[model samples]
Target chain A: MENQPILSVRNLTKKFGGLTAVNNVDLDIYPGEVVALLGDNGAGKSTLIKCVSGVHSPTSGRVTFQGEDVNFSNPIEARDRGIETIYQDLALANNLDVAGNIFLGREKEKSYLGGLIRSLDDKFMRDRSAEALESLHVEIPSLKAPIETLSGGQRQAVAIARAVYWDAKLMIMDEPTNNLGVPEQKKVLELINALRDRGVPVILISHNLPDVFAVADRLVVMHRGQKVTEKKISDTNSEEVVQYMVGALDDTRKAEVVG
Target chain B: MTDGATKNIKEPGKNASKTILLSLMQVWAWVFLACLVLAFIVAVPLVSGSSVSFLSVRNSQNILVAITPVLLLGLGQTFVIISGGIDLSVGWVMSFASVISALALRGAFNAGLPLPLAVLAGLAMAVVGCGMIGLFNGVIIAKLKVPPFIVTLGTSFIVRGMALLMSENTTVIGLPRGVRNYGNESMMYYVRGDGGGFYFFQKPELTVELLRRMDRIITYPVLMTALVVAVAIYALKRTKFGRYTYAIGGNEVAAVRAGVPVERHIIKLYVLSSVTAGIAGFLSMLRFTAGSAVIGDPLLLSSIAAVIIGGVSLFGGSGTVVGTVIGALIIAVLTTGLVMLNVPSFWQFIVVGAVVILAVLIDQTRDIIKNKIGSS
Candidate 1:
């Protein structure tokens, strides 16, 4: 899993007409490693992630996955390529149950008479969904309970489990623990660590320095849509990372200072 | 783990019972149940002192015939409302369908066409015409990004004006005997004895008789309503399309992110809704044997009211087809019962208005309860 980087972004830049939201960012994420992206508000972290996740096309440069330069026109295409984004909203329908939300768009069905009519096999979906949740160690009370009834942490777990069940290779989580309490945050961090142990490349976007320091193997700092600095978590301190995030350190300053 | 799983199953059962009881106590359920009771109460008085004769049967058949088309139209409205849209144009579409089919039949029958072919032509015209209007509504809403309410409201005027123009604001009658018999012919065949004894059954009294009686009681509209309900339930519960509908209704942004063809689904909903309205129109013509420009006047409010009463949320993503059917039946029973009780025609409006308000209140209460449970 650590032999090579699974996803490589080279000189990727995104501009919204007059505003350059993301500028010339290069990142390499390897399998079984956690990369934390940290920035203040409007720091282009979301824009950069959106470019990679196919929510928005990069204005310049390219995203290479498995050594192939690829462009995604939509989220579905991006998801089809084993890149899944877990947005902060979780994007789950509250009215639907766990199984229903898990298989929202891509539902499995049994066909009668050589595929003339398709029928939903509820039993199969329920069993498979239970297996998926169990694999993630998410102890959901029932598959029939609507997601709205689940705790915040459980909802986040379900969203993560859905991505894992779909065989996502590169998982991008945006502020996954922002709204969670201390214990829930601990649960999600553990889930992220578990994901890494399973050889899934995880890109964590967070503002909590302690959270990043706890789990991230590498840190990428972006300021004003540009990659200000990149550092291995072992070699860098929170003060140095904060300096890069607030534009207090430039390339020259970075060279003068050794971590 | 075993204890956890046991609690899981047991808790939902307990919650479901509570929910069912809560739903029973809902104002809509009470109103609907009360209407059924009122129907029986009125029936007793209306038939009192009159021979316990075939008159009751005939009246029941008449009520069914009148209600069938409304039921079909209401079913279509239920789908639209469940998806978080409205279709005021259904009534106009129904009128247009009937008028166009009547005109087509008059021309085709005169040209020595077979009766079945003529009937098919009438149905096709209605379906195509109403379906096109629905498609137009979908296009305006999805492509042009117009709110469904404004688009459908605008379409209602356009369709009504078109129907008026087509019919020249006049009644079109003189449909052939075959078409007339579809609604006019007695569904039941009875054997009468000279001792004032009558044996009421069906045409064959064996296979065809039961089938025929069922057909009469059921009617094509009733059967179509049932089919619509079944299809809707299956789609909403089982199909990917149904899932997407709920998803989109729940959150359009999330649905789009999940790769749902949001625009396409919304368009299809509108088109199917109109198609149902068209079928309802043809059924109305079959029952009445005439197509007037104003044949669908009573349908607009009734259909919307039925769906609302059936537990469909005005804001999409919730409700069931069964709920809508119950709603339509409630309206049908109430209207019939009131007429039997010799209630003033104007007073029926007050009754319906009160019921609609009560249904909406129940819906809001249910929503609040669901949210409270969810949040907890």
Candidate 2:
């Protein structure tokens, strides 16, 4: 029961007009694990998880969450089932404050009997968001500050805190630390480790081998929309992951596919 | 902050100055509008001459009356603009409303309907006309996902043309006295000059007869206009719909991803804008005792201009109705001041156009400063 996968994707494929972006990729994400999805640009790693997170529907495939086959038309529907996707853009409203952005769609309203009007309980949301950040040890300058005013690391922290607070069972983060400074990168890796400590399943899509090997329990490589290799982080080295990433693994098979 | 500098606040003096200047820019949104008001107060008197006080009670009334329709239309545009869209048809929607009410009142008056009943019918007709246009705009823009500029522009022309055709390109005049009374009736009156111990800021206690003898007066319609502005400001700051407007306008895609019903909210915003147009029409028709197909044409761009000057971003996410009210008032002041200064009415065009451009320039400069501060 402890080893069972929390999320499983079978034969997932996504086609954009003529080209197949994700072709027959399969992944099993177990609870309490950080599975690093490593690939070169356009290797279909991002597209595969976007499918699982409901950013895009699979062209032809199946996704099972907690043993139930599901298809969500949008991120909102998937979020209802405890699947959250943190896009590369972060997707935070720049005009809204940190608390407003966090509780945007799922706002908390004051409930004191019934009334004709329902409004956001500002103090409640702000306090809780403060708590959310504090728990993750992420120090934001101000909860009332416009999100655009924050640093790159701060913005990423806000996004992750939102996902964590929503009770997300499976989280798909696309390059969580891209463009972040060295210290900021360390903070993100610590967050990934913390998620593992809480027994939450995380799918980290990254190109940085150092960051990937630091937190990921298993490493999965994809090339040209196909899964090239999968190995436990302890069972493989950075050199092996690189070979699979650049399509340097299994020379005979690569020649046959190319020809 | 560097690790060594973290313990010393003075080490980041440059960064501290940037924050100071950065926050000053944020405060400029309100100060910009205030400066416009101050300009109205200072320059109106400067250019208009000492004998003709621009701050006179009667002139204030005139300013309020002039800006009522602009403010009414502006309130609607503020909602739509905040949601990352614009209603170019609003000015035409007001004309459409005016015609509907006037024609309905005429029909009832001719058919021997009672005066009160005729007025009610006219108001009903205006409401229904505004509702229908709003729904049409909403459906095309929200459901069909058409760009709002194109959709509203097309509708503006169509509605204005329909008004022209229906009115035979002439004025819909001769509205019933009952319908006109509610709009034109002065709710209260004040003494007409700057006298009887009635200084601009002084409130003197006078006998009833003395009050009656006072020559200067401020009218009820002006008070009602302020009432509308006050209510709109309140609703915007304290309601769920208010926050959603900013949310929707700031980043629509983010709003959608967060589960906001972006399409439905936008539809409601259009509906609200048209209702204000309907009200403006009813009142304007009463004031004029007639309506023409071209009544709202010039106001289309002017009302949008008022909003932009008020500090609401043309880009759609960040602004307040309070700013918009101030904006409409500035145009009223600018136009009224220029006219009193004996500027040619046609050249008022260049003056007003220049102000709009100046406003856009200021908005852009503030944004540039903000981005520099943010990146720095």
Candidate 3:
């Protein structure tokens, strides 16, 4: 309880013209904990995370990461600062192989001709990618197979492997279990637990209540662009969470603002 | 985890063989090319009887020379197409380069510059001028977020007009005599004179005996083309720049998310295409010893056709420079072979069009097969 929060969002607000996507949401993520952000469709879960992950600029608020004020202009800046977001789309280039995607933006290169020519170090990258995937107990027949040829679960594993390889301080996953087979969904939850054990704070966004109950230490529920409730895992069950998700319950009784 | 473990125990061998088969399918362009050569060898002799030879070394050299311009343009187009873009301006950019290089050479000669310097100036002017045109295309296409087809198409017209106006809609001639010799000169020439030695770096007068004896004639342009092709193949396959290109083509959003400089990379791809076009333009001028504004006009589609036939998908994200080489060779051989068999020139279009369609059909089949394998 005495540890300083690794990530703190103070009074964050984001609007798309007249439609306010995320409204004055303040949250803190401590190390080694999985905080599940649960909400219905268009409930602003994605917008709030996007603001923190640098996909979109917040209209008003301050994001403090690791005890420093931070505002990132793009996803790359956030990534460089050790914040990795696995988007809903998975954001993998289908044409590139598993190893290639693992080393996508930051590729290892060997220079020749006194640095006049630089070439991708495919052997080194492939070996490293293989090690990373192996550590995660993820298996694909070939590291050289393009991502598009991999199963959905395999692609998701590759995305997670990339984040793991980069040594992310914080992991943000949007709908990590969506469209995945049951066992694949189980693997992802286990991955979240594994990441938490490694002292990496994870912000998990999901519609699946069982997934939230199974792994998260705390739950933050948002409804109609505002935080509806925050609860510890022991204090709340799925039915109560669903009630909050459907806006049947409001923790902040600002009645006039309730949609 | 257990499912994966079980699958892994059984799937590796199956997966490896399936992947190999898939890659073989992707390389159908090479197989098609070999078949075309074989067909020509078998068919040409039967059609022409004793008058023509399709498998002769001389004819092979001629085919190589003929493929030079198309292959160069196709090499450039291969990059653009693999990056999920098309550069319509390349044809006119080539025309522009030819015209500009010719005019610059003539002016350099008029200014009494030495032949080597004049040639260098002409080559530099052509490359730089066309590169600027490519830069312009890249800016609008990448920064301005204009679609490549529309932007390049617009530039193609402007460049075509500029080429016409600059050359006065005529062939720009009056190049120095050495320019002609430089274009025609070979790396080595064999002469059956007194013990038959090889002539190195010299363009001797062709007597009947020398012509008959000159079996190994490797032109300067051919060697230059080979070097260019080699460098291009290496760049596309081995460099990070090449990886970014494929990534951008595969999924631009994903590439951006991965921290790739997508805009800058796209610009580089367009520049690469234009530079190749520029080189093609300069080489064509040398081959003819004259530069005409319209020299590359008819070649635009053929170059694209070669890329298509070589298995570079118009949708982008997958291709190889070696495939483009095979593609160019296929077109060149088809045209040359048909001519040798006394088929009318119009038939070349029919044959090439059919081959292009066939290539696309094969590409689609590859996709369907890959999907099946991937899903399984």
User: A111, model 2: CA deviation in Å?
Assistant: 7.3
Clashing pairs in 1: none
Model 2 Cα lDDT, one tens digit per residue, B310-367: 8888788888898788778778887887787778898778877887887778778877
RMSD to the hidden true structure, all candidates: 4.1, 4.7, 2.7
Best by lDDT: 3
DockQ of all predictions against the true structure, Cα-based: 0.49, 0.42, 0.63
TM-score of each: 0.90, 0.88, 0.95
Per-residue CA lDDT of candidate 1, range A186-227, in tens? 878888987998899899999999999999999999999988
Candidate 3: count of backbone clashes, pairs at least 3 residues apart or interchain: 0
Chain A of model 2 scored by TM-score: 0.92
Output candidate 3 Cα RMSD. 2.7
Query: Tens digit of lDDT per residue, candidate 1, span B175-268?
Result: 8878876655454444333322223334344454343333244555555656766887787777777777777777777777777788998998
B57-167: candidate 3 lDDT, tens digit per residue: 678888988888888888888988998999988888888889999888888988999998888888999889988888999999999999999999999999999999999
Deviating ranges (above 4 Å) for candidate 2: A13-24, A59-61, A111-114, A250-259, B1-51, B108-117, B192-224
The Cα error of candidate 3 at residue B121, in Å, is 0.6
